[model samples]
Structure formats: C-alpha cells, structure tokens
Target: MRSMCCFSALLLLIMAPVVCQGGNILVFPMEGSHWVNMDVLLQALHSRGHSLTVVRSNKSWYIKEKSSYYNTITVSVEKAVDQKFIQKVIYEIMEYERGASRLVYLFHLIVGMFGTFLESHELLGGFVSALLDDAELTTYMKDSKFDLLLTDPCWGGGAIVAKYLNLPLVYNARWLIAGDAHLAIAPSPLSYIPVTGTRYTDRMTFVQRVNNMILHVITQIQLSWVIKDVYQKVCEKYLGPDCDYYQLMIDADIWLMRTDFVFDYPRPTMPNVIYMGGFQCKPAKPLPQHLEDFVQSSGDHGFIIMSLGTFVSELPADLANEIAATFAKLPQKVIWRYKGEKPDTLGNNTLLVDWMPQNDLLGHLKIKLFVAHGGTNGIQEAIYHGVPVVGIPLFFDQYDNILRLADRGGAKILSLSTMDKDDNFLKAIQEVLTEPSYRNNMQRLSRLHRDQQLTPMDNALFWMEFVMRHKGAAHLKAQGNRMPWYSYHSVDVALFLVGALILLLFTVFFLLRCLCAAVCKCKAKRD
Candidate 1:
C-alpha cells in the first residue's frame, strides 16, 4: 500500500504539467451555419484546457455575448450579416431558382446575387474596421497575451486581424473569401477538380470541363475583386503597403479543413492542411423520452429525419405543403425541423419540431434516411452515421455537396424544379428507401471515415497543440504562396527555354547554308 501510494504521487507530479499546459487562443468566427461548427470547435478547445477569447460583431446572430466556455470581445458595427440578411438572401435565391429557366437562373445567380455577396463582404469589412480602429479593443487584444489566432477565413477579416496582431495563425476553414479553401493553397488542376458551383466531378465531360475552367476563372476574378475592393485597402492602411491580403490568408500555419476525402472529391492538398471532416459528429446520446417514444412508435419500418440547416428556418408554403403531402404517404414516421406555418397536408406520421438534436438522431439505429438541404454539416453528419440521404439542394454549394454523394450512389438529388412535378419528391424518397445500394455505400464510406487511427477531432487538436508548442509552423507552410504567378507556374522558365531552342535552330540553319556555299564555289573553281 505504501509503495502504491508513492508511485501514484510520482505519477501525479509527472503528469501535472502535461495536464495543465493551456494556451490563450483568440478566435475570429463568421456568422450563420459557420458559427455552428465553430462553436463545436471552441467547446473542444475549452475541454482540452485551453483559454479562448472570441471576437464578434455586436449584432452577430449566433455568437452569444455570454458563454460558459469562452470570453467574448464584442465590436460595435452598423451592419452585420445576421439571421435576417441570410434568410432574405435564401428566400430570394430559392424564389428566383424555382421561377426562372436554368440559363436565366445561372445569370441571376451571377448578376443578381453578386451585389448581395459584395455587400456581405463590405459589412464584414466594416466590422473588422470597427474592431481594429478602436484603440481600447486593440490594446486589450495585445495585452491579453494570446498564444495564437484561430479563424474561419470565409469573411477575410480574421486573416487581416492575425497579420495586425503578429500572431501564429490557424484556420478552422472550409471556404475562404473566394471559394473552396483547398483551391487557395493546394495544386488544384481544373482538369479533374471541380469548382464549387460547377457540380462536375473528378471525371467531367468536355462541356463540363469547359464550364469548370470558366467557373474557376470567375472565382479568381471574385477573389481579386473582393480583396481589392474590400480587404486590401484595410490591410495596406494597417499592416503596411507590402502586406498583401491574399498572401496573409494563405500564409496560415495550419488549415483545419472541414472536409475529408470521404466527403470531398480527392484533390491535391498542402502539408499544413489537416482534414477534420465530421469532427463535430459523435455517437448519439439517448433522445428525450417523448422523442424516443415517437421514434420507437415507428417500430420495424424505422423513421426519417429532415432538416434544411441553420440558414433555412422555413421553406415556401406551397413547397412545404407538397413535402408534407408526400411524407403523409410514407410508412415511416418523419421528424422535420421546421418553423414555417403548419402545413394543412401534414400527416399523423409526421412530427413537426422547430429544432432537433440532429446529430444524435442521425446516430440512432431507428433512422432510415435523412432528408437534407445538403449543407456540409448535415451531409458530414449523415456520412459519419452511415445514414443514406435524400438531398434537396437549394442554392450555393448544396447542389455540389449532394452531387458528390449521388455520384458515389449514396444519395439521391431532387432539384426544386422537379420536386413538385408528377410526385417526383415522393418517387425520389421511395427509391432511396427501397434501394439497398444507397445505405450500403454510405456505410462503406462511414467505415472508411471511421477507420482512421485517430479521431478527426483528436487529429485537429493535435495539430493545434503542435502549433502552440512551436510558436508557428513555418516549416510546414509552402513559400509558393508568396511567389509571383508567372514564377510559380514556371511560365517565365518555359518562355526562356523556348527562346533558347529557337536561337539554336536558327544558328544550325545558317551554318549549313554557309558550308553549302563554300562547297559550290570550290566545285566551280575545279571545273
């Protein structure tokens, strides 16, 4: 007993430092569904003994001023990308998509939403300006002695803040200001890698490939324009003329990419990029008694769960009624997260809730299928739990996200245009429910995702701590981000080699002509 006690004391002494080694982390997060994932990340960090401080706009819709896990630094701004703004944007986009022709929809998506997109960035820029310009906030941030800055580069303000503060930067990122986060740092060949909105897969047809290239060019244009118009001016004024906003974004020590090969199409990735897709997912806990009772009532047929994600609280009334009517025909019980008007067509089998424990429900054994808006979080959760999906993609990357699963035979996509025509939505759902391949494919992906030696969350935590242990991970970052476009692409080298080859060819021809002339003159003299 004495020996055991001595050994235990020694172990406690040895493990004390490791257990208590916590770093002060500053976070700059985006609003909407982005915050949902970011909140999960923050909770994980807090649980690991790290201190966190989050910066937010006073009008932020999701980020609370008070929290059990982290401290908040609220910056006052006139305008913000809040719930109202997002809902309005989604409503307009959905309405336009449903009413217009495909080509016209494409034009509307580009031209109609461009102003709103630009305005979102402008609002974010205003928030950033407000935060940095305030002397008190700047002083407080500096005095806080933060070890690192964690941010979602979706808004671009976080990268700028990291530069101004001279902190080691890490990204909890899927999208940067422009498009997919991978495109900014990785060697993405448009031949195979599809752009965000193009919906092309690794094997694209010729026309699709052409569209991919055009979309990629448009993304570049968007990136350049946003940086120049919104972020670059602020960077130049604050971080010096040499501080390029694009470079600052790509210079982060690590990118905790919110996607894995299981969810995302395979592509080239950087050394510093750590794929942590479905990190927010875990085994389901016991559902509330009422919910469990409802789930249990379905018996052998199981149940279907539907959610349209954070931005969409409710869909259009006619669409909702159509969906309800279809669900009324189903044998399985349905639990739908909706805040819209109670549809008159809603059936006895359907339970309408304004909110749900989505992740928990996905993990349940009684789950038959997921009806989703194809948000990254929902799709990734479905993948993690091996639940087959019925994806109704609406706006933005939803189509692309759903198509990835559709190509793999794990999900079925029912576009809004065809959803109501000839009971297409009902047919799509029934097809998925009847198909064994869908569930089997999703389960196979789940196995692949889960077969990792370390959990994705643990992997993310390891890399984050690795960054803190060493002040910054300069060794892992590529210098190509700083290189000029021509130099990085080797266009200058190619031009030089071509010029040299042309000169050599000309010289050889000239020498041959001279030799022929000499030989002809000698022959004439002999004659």
Candidate 2:
C-alpha cells in the first residue's frame, strides 16, 4: 500500500476516503491530444496514489509528458500511428458525406466501410503483432502483474492486452453523446437518444427513429464481424487459444463514459457507466503574453478565435482567403489556428498561428465568437466559457456537435463546402457575433452545467476507486452484455409469442368452420 503522502494539493480532499491502497494501473490510450478526457482521468488516478504505467505508441502525445506518479513505455511498430491515417478516416467519411438528400441513411454505409478499413489498416495488425510478438514486453507485463487495465474501448489494442493478461478492464470513451459502444455496454434507450453524428434529438420522428435503427444495427453488425472471428484470431495467436477476447470487453469492471445528463440530453445510463464529461476542462489560466496583448488590443469589439482542432487540416488557401476576406469586413480581430502557409489573400484583421491555448482563450472575457470544427471538446469548452459559436463543421461527429449547439440558440452552422459562395456562411458569423441571445443562452447552459453536485473528475475518481475497492466492480456490470443479441433485444421471445398466437388463431378458425358445417347439416335434417 502506497502512503497518501504522495498525493498533491488538488487531490488531498478526494483522497480522504481512499485507504492509501491502490492498484498498479495500465492505461492504453489511443494516440492524440484529443484524448484530453483520458489524460485527466489518468491524472486523477495518479493523484489518488495509484501506480500508473502507460504503454504508448511512438506517435502518442503523452509519451513525453510523463509525471512523478506515472511512467510511460514507448513501443515502435512497423506501421506507425500517424495522423495521416486518421485524416484518411476523415476523408473516407467524405465518401459518404455527399448527397445527404439521397443518402439519408449514409452513416450506416459509412460505419460498415470504416470498420473494414480499420481492420485492414496496417497499424491495427502491426501494433497487435508488435505487442504479442515481442516476448520481452509480454513477459514484462506478466511479471509486473497489473491488477487493472484501463483503456478506451475505442482502441481495440487495450482490450487485446487486457484479455491477454487476464486483467480487470475499465472502458473509457469520450462522448457526451453516447455512441454504439455505449449502447452495447448499457441500457441505452434509443427512443429518445440521438444516434451519434446524426444530429437527431431524443424525441425523434418516426422516420428519424427508423434512421436511428439503421445506424445502430449496421454499426453493431460491422463491429461484430471482426470482434469475434478476426479479433479472437489475434488473441488466440498469442494467448494459446485460451484467451476470451470478447469476454474482456463484456466483463469490463466499469465503463467511464465521458458524458452526463448535465451536458448531454436525458438518457438512462447503466449502473456501471460513470459520467465524466467535463473532466478535461480545467479552470482557465492566464493567456500567453502575445495572445493577451492581441486580445487586449481588440478592446470593445473583442477577438474571435477559430480552431479546426489538432488533426483536421487548415482550410484550403482559397477558402481561407474567402473567410479571411469576410472577417476583414468586421471590426473584430480574428485569431485563426492554422498551421498551413499564409494565404496570399490574408486580410489585415486575421492573425494565423500554428496553435493557441484553446481552453484558456475561450475563457477570455474579451472573446466574442468561437469559429470551430464542431468537435465535442471544442463545443464543451465553448459552453464552459459561455462563448457563442460560429461552427464550420468538418467530418465525423462535428456535424452533430454543431447542430446541437445551433439548436440550443448559442451557435450557427456554416458548412465548409458552401463557404466559398454561400451568403449564409458569412451571415452565420455575423449573426453569432452581433447576437445577444447567443451569449445569454450560452451562459444559462454554462450555469446549469456548473450546478452539478460533483465535479467531473470527482465523479470519475469516486467511481474509479469504487471499482478498485470492490475488487473489479463485478456487481455493477449488467447481464445484458452477456446475453445473445436475439435474447438481449427479446427478438426470440417476441417470435415465440407471435408463433403461439398464430397457432391459436389457426385452431380457432378450424373449429369455427367445423361448427358452421354441423349447423348447416342440422338445419337440412330439420327441414
């Protein structure tokens, strides 16, 4: 047992309930800064005196950022976890992005194709082989004997490792809006729940409900295809065929969902699903001097910050110029987060930089508008700071994120494809800038979000320790995951009932026919 003396100032209060006993935790997070929620989670675990060893891909951003309580081990695979591959995932999304009027159920096809793509991707196979094939790494993990393997199931590697070592697993996924993973794990009521990236609300229309089913069914089918046969093969290759690859996911001790009713729409989560939506958002610190100077100079008009997030590319030169040209017409200064070369048509009002402290800048009082890629984290940060948004959404969940904010009256969507000639794109930027209701509505939501009983990190820490204390939190897991699809959805029961009703109807019809014939014969005899 580690002493509570290792805890820092921020953790002292929360660490009280814990008895200075914590497990050696292994975190296998997907690669990127977008895993911000996961980072906060690991930090909280570390703060509570847990020994954390994170296995990072060479490309992971967290490899260099290891602190006192945690260590990082880097592994180099033949096929690297590159941003280009992630970008390709986005581009393939473009394949289905077209003609939404005709392809209303496009997400199903997108979901189907994407799973196959990821399966065939060299990175997935290479990483799995690299880990399992490396005798030293596997031996080290076995010798160290971690009690818990913490991972976001979004990355299959986490599940693989947990299954291989027969460790207790906790699934973490970042989506205030529940995705297919959430549905599989718990009692996700599809009736009101909007399908991820679909932009529907809980009270979906009949057609929307049908579309939701399409998204859910197709996603599940695609995921299932590899989950058992292909994924199990990977496990069997190394674990001598005894490892139950699918069972690790099913037997997960807890699911730490990065969402809550406070930030998300109302939905019933499972007993084991812990809400930790705003864990990534910290209190804003002072801006860097240059940024502070720039914002201060904007004075009453204030500055608008535009970021397309970490992985997405900057706008095309022509499009960037067009957006810049529009911005030049307004009095407000624009800080655009773009790493690409400066466009020749760059306007005087725009300052293009490689990066900006997104959360800190959003917190700035002088900020007027946030032009963003409509990622959840960006939207969450904007809401946290009570800043209205002008969202130019890119692929994946961005459309849905922007739509939700727009529906809330705090944002306006300006589709990137239409930005070149569309008056609405320019109008949206102006509307969010000049509108008072946007800010007012945003502030109302910000207050509601902050009015929660516990902080996101606290909620996460409590539940994480709860899992640890109880020795894997088995009681909280629902039996629904163990049931077959036919049983879980009650399809088999419904079919049985339908068959019985059909049989009863057939017998009744036959009896009625016989009685009618007997009555006719009696009538003839009496006549």
Task: Say which candidate scores most in TM-score.
Answer: 1
TM-score of each: 0.97, 0.86
Across 1-527, the per-residue lDDT of candidate 2 in tens digits comes to 25455556448767765658777888877666546667777777877778899887776543554567678767776566577766666655543443343254364446555654555433654676777778898899889878788887765667778777878778787531124456666577777787775668677999998888877776566566656645666767767677766665567787877666645776666787777776777778999999898889887999999898878655556676787778777788889988777877777878888878899998888999999888778888888888898887766678777777777788887765565675666788888777799999889878877787898778878876776666688788778878877998899999999999999999999999999999999999999
Clash number by candidate, in order: 0, 1
CA RMSD, predictions in order: 1.5, 5.1
For model 1, how does the per-residue alpha-carbon lDDT over 1-527 read when each residue is reduced to its tens digit?
99999999999999998877999999999888899999999999999899999998889879999999999999998789988988899999898889888888888887778889989999998888999999999999999989899999988998889888989999999998879998888899999999998877899999999999998888789889989999998899889898878888799999999999988888888899999999999999999998999999999999999998988888889999999999999999999999999999999999999899999999999999999999999999999999999998998999999999999999999888889999999999999999899999999999998999999999999999999999999999888888999999999999999999999999999999999999999999999
Worst 10 residues of 2 by lDDT: 96-105
lDDT of 1 at 78: 79
- The alpha-carbon deviation from the true structure for residue 24 of candidate 1, after best TM-score superposition, in angstroms, is 0.4
